[model samples]
Target: MLLLVHAALTFMLVGLILMVQWVHYPLFAQVGAATWPAYEREHQNRITFLVGPLMLAELLSAAWLTLHPPPALPSWSVWLGLVLTLLIWVSTALVQSPLHGRLSAAFDARLHRQLVVGNWFRTLVWLLRGGLCLWWLTLLL
Candidate 1:
């Protein structure tokens, strides 16, 4: 049950990250400078609403799975998932949040580009995590 929930959350996060990396972040520059601050603020707020609970759930589920992995799933895979989750959290705090903060104050093209590029780290991590989940799911069959 725990493994299933973890897999589902990770998969959902991967989908969200892909959209943010490819669609949402790139479009930030298209917003007019005068309205960019308000737009960015609203974006941040709305995204938090969507991402916050899922992130927390993912983190908790990853921790649980790490501590008590299912019999068929390898321990190393669970550890890797936990590590990926940590990297995602660290990247959000150190890289993405700062970029969002800067954009919230005022739109900067360079910062916008950095946000889009740096987001790939999270995107890739989530993708890897999702793959790990799928592998574990396959083991169940």
Candidate 2:
């Protein structure tokens, strides 16, 4: 049951990250300079509300799975999931959050490009976690 929930949450994150990476980030420049700071602030606040719980759940669940990995599962899978989860968290804190902070202060074209590019790492990480969860689910079944 826990694994199922984890998989569902991971899939949601994967979808959201893809949306943010390809669609949302690209549109930031169009927000225009006068309102960009406010727009970015709202984005940070609102997106936190949207993704925070999901990410927390994912992290907790990944930890849980790591500690109580299934009997049939290959040992490395759970460890890999936990590692991927940590990578996402670390990347968000170290790379993406700072980029967002910079953009929130004011839109810089160079920084905007960096955000989009840096976000690709997180997006790919989420996708890998999604695949790992899917594999675990299949193994459980």
Tens digits of per-residue lDDT for model 1, 1-141: 998899999989999999999899999889999999899999999999999999999999999999998899989999999999999999999999988998899999999989999999899999999999999999998
Please list the residue runs of candidate 1 whose C-alpha ends up more than 4 Å from where it truly belongs after superposition: none
* Model 2 stretches astray by more than 4 angstroms: none
lDDT of 2 by residue, 1-141 (tens): 888999999999999999999999999989999999999999999999999999999999989988998798888989999999999999999998988987888899999999999899999889988888888888888
**How many clashes in each candidate?**
0, 0
Which ten contiguous residues of candidate 2 have the minimum total lDDT?
A: 132-141
Cα lDDT, all candidates:
0.93, 0.92
Local lDDT at 123 for model 1: 96
Tell me which residue pairs clash in candidate 1: none
Give model 1's TM-score versus the native structure.
0.98
lDDT of 2 at 12: 96
Pick the lDDT winner: 1
Clashing pairs in 2: none
